[model samples]
Every structure is written in C-alpha cells, then in structure tokens.
Target chain A: MRTFSAVYCEWFKLDEKRYLDEVKRSANSHSPFIYPTMELLNENLDNFINHQEETVISFSQLTQYLVMKLAHENELKVLLDGQGADELLVGYDYMTGYYLNQQLRSLNLKSFFEELLTVIKRKNVEGLQLLSYHFSPNFLRKKILYRNKKYLSNRLNNIISQDNFYLSPMYKSKSLTTALIVNVDYKLEKLLR
Target chain B: MTFGIETRVPFLDFRLVVYLLSLPDEYKYKKGTTKRILRDALNEYLPELVKQRKDKIGFASPDFKLLKELDEKHWS
Candidate 1:
C-alpha cells in the first residue's frame, strides 16, 4: 500500500539529465521521494568490495546496495519489488524472439533442438537429463513426423518444458502443468523469498 | 541479505503467477510490446499517459555518470 520513490543522479552526463528529468516528473506519483546524493559514491564503492573480496561489482548490484543503504537510513524495514514478472510473462525481447522463432521454424526443429542441447551442455553440468530427453532419436523423430493439432499442442508443451529445463536436476517431468508448478514453487518463490 | 532489509515481491503471488503462466505467449507479448497482459489489465486504472508509455527503465541509476565524473575530476 505504501509507495516510495528514489532517484540516483549524476551532475555530469547530458543523457543522464533526461533520466533525472523523468524522475522529477514522476516524483509526485509516489510518496516520500528519496534522493541519494553523489556523496555516497565512495561509501558504495567501499561496500561493494568489503564482503566478497574478489567478486566484481556490477552496476546494478551497486545500485541495489545503494537503495538498501538509503532504506536503512530512512528506517524503512521492508521494500516491495516487482521481480519475477518478466521471466513469467516473457517480457524480455530475447525470450520473445526465442519463442517466436521456435514456433515459426518447425522444419528446423532438429538442428535447433540440437544447438540448444549443445549450449545447455556447455553451460550447465546438470543438464544431462534434459539433454537426453531432447537428444533421443525416437522422440525427435516423433516430434518431426507428427503434424496434427495434437502434435502442435504437444510441441507447445515441449517448448514450455524446455524453457524450464534448468529449474532442477529432478525436473525430468514433461507435463506442462507440473512444469509451471515447479517454476512457480522453485524458481519464482525462491527469488521472492 | 546484506542489508537486513526485507524485500517482498507482490507480483509473484501464486494465483497471479499461475494465471500469467497459463495464458498464451501472445497475450504476454505482442508486436514487440512486452508485458502486454499487464498493460491491458491496468489500462483503465492507470493514467492514460502512464498506460501509453512503452519504455521499461528498470531501477536504473546514474552510477556510470558518477564514475565518469570521478574519473575526470581525479584521474584526468
């Protein structure tokens, strides 16, 4: 129910002036706007490397740390975020491209699935089960041969399943319903928690 | 976890998430528009200008500009 606004501004860049202007324009939309000054730059830099020692600090992580620091200073204990909506809603342009391409390029399913499996193999060590499911000759043949409405429906299900292949090592279940549940329970819940 | 401040994501509500996931991909994204369903759902409640805005600037900060300023002031 409570809404808070904050803006981090730099007095230098012309492009960032637009960002500052936008923040100022939207200031009235939320209550208690908190402007974290440039003076905290050194403190934020110090905090970034204080814990991990060797970990590289990304810009987003630094911004998050600054927000947390500001919240602490203001004595605000809880903050509400709008995370997990993007992943669930396919809000990212890359994901949209992936889904649209997979849907339109049915003829290239074999090579596409193979490339995906290869990437998964290289990036992830626990993707063996998912790789096996996609790499099976029998499954690939059936998926390629079947061209009915039922097959299309199954393909959609497979797409969702493939999207969630990295949720858990035990995520071998092919059911879309179960996959959705697992994604919500394991991934989204873990993030929000 | 470092800040000791609790962050809650209300958008990840179980029912809402289930409904979103169950909806077709077209409903979620359409013609390069992201969060289409969310925009459509909140169309009536939000201001017309707010609803019409397209860009999604997510928690952006001016850290780059700050760093540039520091570099010019101290290093240069």
Candidate 2:
C-alpha cells in the first residue's frame, strides 16, 4: 500500500539537489498507480470535467478527485476526509489576521502583540505590513475583492462595485470566530456537496 | 464523495463543531498556530512531528510545474 509519504516528499527537504534526485529515483521506481499522477490527470481530464457537475475552483479539488478514484481502485469502501477542520478550527493562514483583528478590537493588546510576534517570526514578514489588514477587516476584504477583480466576470465586477452591495453578515466582524462562521456558511456548503 | 466510496467527515460532527465554536477564538488559533486545541488534545496520541507540523498540505499536490502544464493544456 503506497501511503501519502511514499507518493509525495516533504515540503522543504534540507538538501535541494539531493531531494530532486531522490524524487526522480522514486518516480522511476514506483511508476505509480496509473502512470505519473499529473499525466493521469491529463489523460482523465475529459472524464474528470464530465464527472463534475459544478465549477472547479482549485487544482487541489482535482487532486482530491484523483485520490478518491485511486482509493476506489484500491477497494477502499470508505474514506475519512478532514474537510471541516479548517473552518471549525480557524486553520487557514489568513485567519491569523482575523484573530489579530479580534484581539486588537477587544482591547486585548497583550494577546495581539504576542500573536503578532509569533506570526512575524514564523512567516518572516514585517509586522507593520500586516497592521492595515489586521486593524481593518472591511478594508482588507475590499482590498482582496479588488485584487481578485481580474478573475471575476464583468457582471460580477459590476455587482460588487455597487456601493450598496450586500456582503455577508460577517463582513463587519473582525473576529476569527465570525470569519469561521462565514466560511462554514458559504465555503463549506459547496465542499459538502 | 465519488467512485462508489462514501466520505465521512468526523470534524463536522454537530456536537464537536458546536463545542469548538463556543470556545474563545484564541483557543482555536493562538501564537501563530491554527488548530491549537486539536494539536494539544491529541498531543499524547499523535506523533510529535505530526502535532508540530506547521504546513497544511491537505492532499494538494506540490508539483507546481505539473499543475502549470495542466492549466495551460486545459485552457489552451
């Protein structure tokens, strides 16, 4: 049984050249379940697109489909998916900004600073760059939407550009909890289907 | 859920979900660590490396070149 580790190496191996060589060696040795993974994707692209009755957002979804198909071929009757963990547990990196915003909003400066420092150290980013987003959730949300405008259809852009456009209930909220609620209400529903 | 296989999501259990939601936000994410409570709760049971892992790959492929090729092929 080929596990996840057998398929994919860790994100950051210490030696880059050695890691690439090892990956090439393993790819040659394993040959995988149905050719190489990506080639399988290319071969099955038409079937995959037909299989989906709705829109596809990310390549992760495609990979997940491939995994489920592989599991089925392996005769696995049931699979456990960790889907709701991120929404329930505030697991996304962007949620850190919401958490910091909550801390600052609630007059929890000590906690805010503590979390801010940890984020800075872990991500190696300047703290000041994060402040505008952390302090103003509305601004951050608008900025995000504006940045994503190119990806949106003209109809979507026009709709969102309206001053009275109704955002979700959580729009005004800076709390991570509220953000998670919005994710559950909107994002998780799609994934559930 | 596809390919005649059933998918179960334990984390979406109503009781557990509600319990997590009711807790303070900081408990869920603190000190740059998301899922802090889960990591702590499973500390005794989970391997040290898993509990300490900061990256959340979530079964996504790491091969960007392959993905780029696929994207180009699909769009083109």
Candidate 3:
C-alpha cells in the first residue's frame, strides 16, 4: 500500500519493519502484529464505539481516531488533514467509473476508449468491476453483490432486503462534475466531521 | 472528534472547492491519471517519484489481516 511505502520513504534509525511497526503503533495502539495482546484491541474498540456514539462496521475511522489520540498525547492541539482532495479532484481510482460514464453519455468515443484501454491495462479486472458498478442499478447491484458475499455483513444485507434503503443521489449523477459535488456534499462531509 | 485536537482541511475551503468544481472533468482526470491539476500545479514542488506514483492509499490500516486473526467470538 502507498501508505506503507510512504513510511519507507522517510529516513529512519530503525529497520524497515521496526519503523513501520512504530508508525502503526503510534497511529493505533492496537495495530495488528505490533501489539502482543488482544486486550488493547478490545479496549480500543470499545473506547472508539463509545466515543463515536454510532453504529459503524468500518474500522477505518478507528485508525484515524487513534492517530488523533496520538497527536493529543504528544500535546499537539491542532492538525491539518489532507482529506478533501480526493472528493474534489476525483482522485480515487474507482472514480474512473463516473468519468467514463460521463464520457460515454456525451458520446466522446475517443476519450472513453482511450481511458478504457489505459484502465484495462493498468487496473485489469478491478477497472471492469468499477465500470459495471457504475452502469448497474443501485438496488440490483447491492442485492447481487450481497448475495454473492462481495460485501456487507449478512445481518446488514438482511436489513437492506427488508427496507427501501438503496437510493443515493450518486447513482443518478450524469457527469463527473455532479458526482464530485455529491461526494463533497455527502461522503467528504462525513469524513471531515 | 473527542481528542481535543482541532482539525482543519485547507482543500475544503469553500472558495477552493467551488473553483475546482467549476473546472472541466478532464482537468481533474485525463487518460489514466487522476488529480491532473494538482499534479501539474505541484509538479515543481513534488519529487519525481511522487509525481509519477499512480497508487494512493488513504488512511487505511491492515484491518483484513487483523480481523482474520481475531476470534469469531469477538464479534458476538
């Protein structure tokens, strides 16, 4: 992962593994393979859950929370995060789907094919998956993916099946501009919180 | 949010975001490259390796391996 490699790019007195381990530990005390016991993991999970006051299956926020905790411990009272660039600039790899869809809708064959070939060469199957997801209906896609165990916990899938919960403004976006705007209004807003 | 630290995001400034949003799509992504303008604008300040790097990993931890090693009972 680029994050792991970025750690290696820095000057370090310790060996690579040790340096990474230290970095991970600083970000999250219960980072896997760094701590010797599960007690810290359980304790941190409970602490995170209580502090967040919401149900979240994803632990990505916990990693960030722990990083802030580290900052707090070091007496750092303010931090500047590079968080909104991806949503604003459409910098994420999966975002190719939105861009490609826009190009196809506008009948920009040259741009579409050019980008498609590059994505196929670089990302292979993952690029194809992004394209399929963009073209598919939101509910149908979630149903198929959940049935195939591609994502979502079984309990959450059951809840989804029972409710009308699949609608998102993002699926209706007809251009990359609209998609970026939606992401900023919805996804990035959550992250910035 | 409860760590008593104030977090700021300069990129999310309304003025900057509005400006970026107004740009054409190709300005953000071209061919296979993402963040086209950012890379181009920061080309001089960024190292060659960073400028050329395609892969980006954002605030991600090794959660899959950790969950695999964790006991199933932990979830219950």
* Best-first order by lDDT: 3, 2, 1
lDDT tens digits, residue span A1-193, model 3: 1121212122322114444454454445433322212445666887888898976544466756666766676667777778889888877776777777778889999988998888887764444555676678765665433342224577775776544233346645667788788778776647668
> Whose lDDT is greatest here?
3
**Model 2: residues >4 Å from true position, as ranges?**
A1-36, A124-131, A134-141, A149-168, B57-64, B71-76
Best by DockQ: 3
Between candidates 1 and 2, name the one with more favorable lDDT.
2
Residue-wise C-alpha lDDT for candidate 2, range A76-140, written one tens digit per residue = 78767777888788766656766777778889999879988888777723223334544456656
| lDDT tens readout by residue for model 1, A42-76 | 55677666843653323555656666766776777
Model 3, residue pairs in steric clash: none
> Model 1 Cα displacement at B14 (Å)?
3.6
Best-to-worst ranking by TM-score: 3, 2, 1
iRMS per model in Å: 9.0, 5.0, 5.2
Q: What fraction of correct interface contacts does each candidate retain?
A: 0.53, 0.68, 0.66
Interface RMSD of 1: 9.0
- List-wise, what DockQ does each model earn? 0.34, 0.49, 0.52
